[model samples]
Target chain A: MIISEMAFFLLVTGALILTVLAPVVLIGLFIKDYFSKSIW
Target chain B: MTEFALDTQTALFIIVGFALAWIAFGVWLGRKNKSHEDFALAGRNVGYAFAAATAMATWVTSNTTLVAPQLTYQLGVWGMVGYSFAALGLLLFAPMAKRIKQILPQGYTSGDFIRLRYGRFAWAVFLVISVVYAFGWLVSLGMAGGILLEALSGLDYYIGMTIILAMCVGYTLFGGLRAVIATDFIQALIIILGVAVVAYWLIDNVGLTSIHTELSHAHPQLLDLLFPAAVMFLFNNIFFGLGEIFHSNVWWSRALSFRKNVAYKAYLTGGLLWLPIPIVTGFIALAAPQLGIFPASADMIGPAVASSVLGKTGAILVFIVVFSALASSLDSLLAASSDLVTQDIYHKLIKKNASDQQLMRFNRYCILSLGVMTWLLCLPRVATLGALLNFAGAFVASTIWPIVIGLYWRRLQGIFAGIAMAAGTIVGLVAYFWIGFYVAALVSCAVSGLICAIGVVFNKSQFSWHQLQENEQ
Candidate 1:
């Protein structure tokens, strides 16, 4: 039971991390596109 | 009425402020439009960043933010994971987007591909499916905007719905696809940051150990790895998402609008970015019971948990995130669906000789009309958002096989493609009533695939790839 609970926590935490990181990566790419004048 | 997390006045102020800002930005972006192509397809030169952002943001819809948690609350852990599988729609579409760019370089809508590839009969059938799915989604998003506001703040359903619909239509009317894509870039950022903030707060405040322990004691099925119903729903949701993206003009127009080399990678990046969102959003619902926040309706669980946990600030965040999600999808659907009407119905069928300027005017009118129609349908708030979306599964999933086969294979005939969509939809609807919503898309996709296989095996005439090109016109 404890093992299952730990797994669930790990899964949520991992997903949360990815979710937070996604915007940072996208915003960086957006800046690159903006500087290149590629964002038509 | 139920008590709200924030006061109605603050909600109204935020809603109005966002509406004005988005509309003004849209008008500013519209200044560069010179032709129909510019209006409908953003001059067909959208960059990688905007394309990927629009794709991801549009897919991170009310369904992802609201219905995902609702399903998780109901179907447990597998439900949230199943919801995330919707990213497969965008991922699989990467190859199709490339093919769309290659085959029909001048394509304007998904309807154009169907008409050219399969002919009028299949195109007509495809249009019905497309319109139904678009309106279903549009109405759901409109209603979700209202429902979100009402859940977090003491706003009336009708007022919230009207503000959202009008705001999206106003901007889409002004800037067309360019405005839609640009706003989508910002909205995408807001939605992601807001969802992440709420999830992070929930984790920090409630602690995952406590959440898991509470769920284990109270809602054990949510933690069950092999939960049967959620397992069943997993693939069905995937097929539904695939069908929605594959056949709808929303994704199709984005594919067509992007610079040639950017379509594949843009969709792939979008899918990857979108993959974890449902899990993050849905995880918040699992903490509902632990937080002692029981929403009157399951669909409100996401906002309720966020607001109840973090108080007024959380309510404001939920409001903005959901509003952005709704507007992102709404504007895209309006622009894409209107493009379908203008290109496929008005230009192709009604006035084949209509000038570019005339077509652009017609497209704007179509957007306004579509907004009105969706507003009427959303007025009553007839069904839960989840149920309304799932019901559309039967209609859209039927188109998956025909589109996939038509794109890559050469043997499938127009008549068979039409028959496959029609027959698959009928059977899928029957199964929806007879079996369950979870099986509708699965059954529809299976039936359509079977019919498409039969069409391929029995086909005699070979379809030339060049028929899909605009040169035929």
Candidate 2:
């Protein structure tokens, strides 16, 4: 069953976005963690 | 005409070959086991590649080979894709690894982290849930092994299971992490090559056109690369995988086995490497429709379907792959779980002054006892694979947030972390027996996330950044 080209594009785009965003989220969390350190 | 004959012989060869190599490697490393720490965590000097491969190989056990294809048989395209979500477990571990190593660089087990990160009340609750989770998982693999052997060798399930479990436990009991890692590298290599070969040959035998032709009408959903069911399961499967790796001693021990720098890259490399295995190996079951061979259980789809397509030879190849997969994982679990006993339960509590040599001796004895317990438990094969595993999934989901959030959020007070873990576990456990584990996990994750967020919001006290940097030394 051939997925509609439109659906194919959507899924591919979604997966690609996730793949890229996963690392970004990790890095972002790390940055947040770094800044939140105790002042003392 | 014997079923899985080719697979059996081919598998036997690979098993013997890998075991021999492992024996050689074990002998070289075995006597060097100077302490329980050396045996269990490799003195924390393992490199990225070894850590990554062992982690990937162990996580992708019989379930990937069995359940994933079974899912494909029914859920169609979503089955393998849903299973592929497991790779997220490895990828998600990367950041979690760095944070965990920083906070608890010398941590011995998952229990050790929970002990330091939370309170005894929470740790006790976590341990009960953990024991059940570990046994549930061990039994799932056991039941799968029993059924697989029954199918291939025509041997009774009990006999077949004993053989497989004993072989794995035997090697693992003596070798420690060094042995587990050495064998795992070989096992991982064999499994990868075997899966690729059968997949290539499968496409050749049935051809993609025929597969599409047969699958299009009977189960058109299989053809839809991203069907509705796949999307529905997408997030759940991801959480399931994440929960298992995130909270378990299995992954934590691997983290502890590596040098600090090696730990991070190992997780990253392991993540990327595992991404394609589900797609590569599990899709062969799509060819099941072409053969019209539907085993009563779907997890059996990979072995049965592959055997039919490649004939006896393919069956044997699968057996070898399964052997490698099972041994690699069982050994890792045995070694890691024994480490837990040595560190968390033994050295810490019973024998604070125990020399490293004395501790190593106790570890081997613990390995023997635990092996017997898991063996006796596996004898029954009580629950269906999916039900048993989903229940185990709930247990881990209970730990995920406390683990993930607690790692990054040091301001996380022990009380809040304790409440999050305990309350989430209570709710999840209640849901599992009353409702189902998936629902339990869903509720647990949501509730635990809220509790953890509340802890963050309140900010009673915070850990200094300098403390973490200093601890790494």
Candidate 3:
């Protein structure tokens, strides 16, 4: 029942990749909102 | 006491600098809030980005930063994964948020809906649950601020706790929900980047493979998928999260505040963005044993290990991220709880004829009182962050069935809904004391759900959706 190292690596790395993309998505949305003047 | 990572002076400097800047930002944001609606619900015109960011950032509380690591340290891999499952709370609430905005277009708090939908007895019960859970969460966040400072540097717990409480109240008192949402956007970005940097450092420098190999050799249970206690913890955590989001005014207020057609997508995006965070933050603790760093308290493992590996810079980064996480949630709770007291109790009960100016002023005073009350309670350092939060889980999980059923179903009578919440919370608390924290939410949810099912079966009247559309006095 132990987690394989490969599974462990994928979990962390995949999470890391998603975590890194969060800022990009958030900023892009902010820019869109800012241009449209709807960020309130 | 122990060898500090950043010196006390440096820690104090960081606190003062950030506190001043955030308060000034709060004042700047307060300029647009001329009406009670503006202060309390951010003009009820919030757009997608800010709504989504506030939703994500506020959910990233002391629990995510501090308790996630503690759970991972204690319950192993299942703990972090179980923690991430909390995102389901937000995801599930997405459509419900849209429904809330549609039905209660003029609603101020979750208390409003409960009162209108269920009547006085259930509203009273719901209010008690809301107050208890709000204080529980507020105290935990306050304690976490103190704990974070004390863990990183040699800062006094009392000073650290007081400063954080004061800063949140100061800003929230003036800027209201507008400031809370605006700051949340920036804090969301800061939290994400900070966590990413720390995790990346661990991977680049320490290597996850070595960390995994070490855990397998030394702490085999950490990788055990079938770990018994962790398996039990999975469902309980999910229920706890569901209860928190479904029942609390914090999420409801955001749903009320977002502009037309924004609540659903905002919450969905926020949940997806939030799903991976606990994994990133929690995995950092798996490296603790490999680094030969054991903290005095399990909750300190996140900061202790990060500081040990990345040194002073890492300590600073952890401080800011955790601090932002604390403020984002703290201010939201303060504002939301104050809204509950102002709109639900004060305006509805005490003075029905109060003007907008009076309501706004009273809301500010409520924020101040809540901050002071939380500070006094946090002075004792009653329990570890994880324990205190889970204790509230029993209280909140009791509200899950009542809230969900009330929203979509018309058959549940007020008396039965009241009985359901009261019975659920009582059983949940009994379980928390007798069995353990892990089963409290599960037991509570089950009891409440059973009662709600009976209520739905026996009740005979259909509630008009028009009842929810209460206008301002």
* Stretches of candidate 1 exceeding 4 Å from the true structure: A1-3, B470-473
Estimate, for each residue in B1-473, the C-alpha lDDT of model 1 and write its tens digit: 27778899999999899999999999999998989999999999999999999999999999999999999999888889999999999999999999999888888888888998999999899999888898999999999988988888878889989989999999999999999999999999999999999999999999988988888888888888788778889999999999999999999999999987999999999999999999999989999888887778899999999888899999999999998999999999999999999999999889999999999999999999999999999999889999899989999999999999999989999999999999989898998899988989999989998999999999999999987764444
lDDT of 3 by residue, A1-40 (tens): 8899999999999999999999999999999999999888
The second chain of candidate 2 has a TM-score of 0.92
Q: Which pairs of residues clash in candidate 3, taking residues 3 or more apart in a chain or in different chains?
A: none
Q: What DockQ class does candidate 1 belong to?
A: medium
Residue clash pairs of candidate 2: B6-B316, B7-B315, B7-B316, B8-B316, B66-B299, B70-B298
The Cα error of candidate 3 at residue B368, in Å, is 0.3
Residue-pair clash count for candidate 3: 0
Second chain TM-score for model 3: 0.99
Model 2 in CAPRI terms: which quality? incorrect
Q: Which ten residues in a row have the lowest lDDT in candidate 1 chain B?
A: B464-473
Tell how far residue B233 is off in model 3, in angstroms. Answer: 1.2
TM-score of each: 0.98, 0.87, 0.99
**lDDT against the true structure, each candidate:** 0.92, 0.71, 0.93
| Candidate 3 chain B, poorest ten consecutive residues by summed lDDT | B464-473
Instruction: Give me the displacement of residue B466 in model 3, in angstroms.
Output: 1.9
Report the CAPRI category for model 3.
high
Q: Which candidate leads the pack in DockQ?
A: 3
CA error at residue B391 for candidate 3, angstroms: 0.3
Candidate 3 stretches with Cα past 4 Å from truth are B470-473
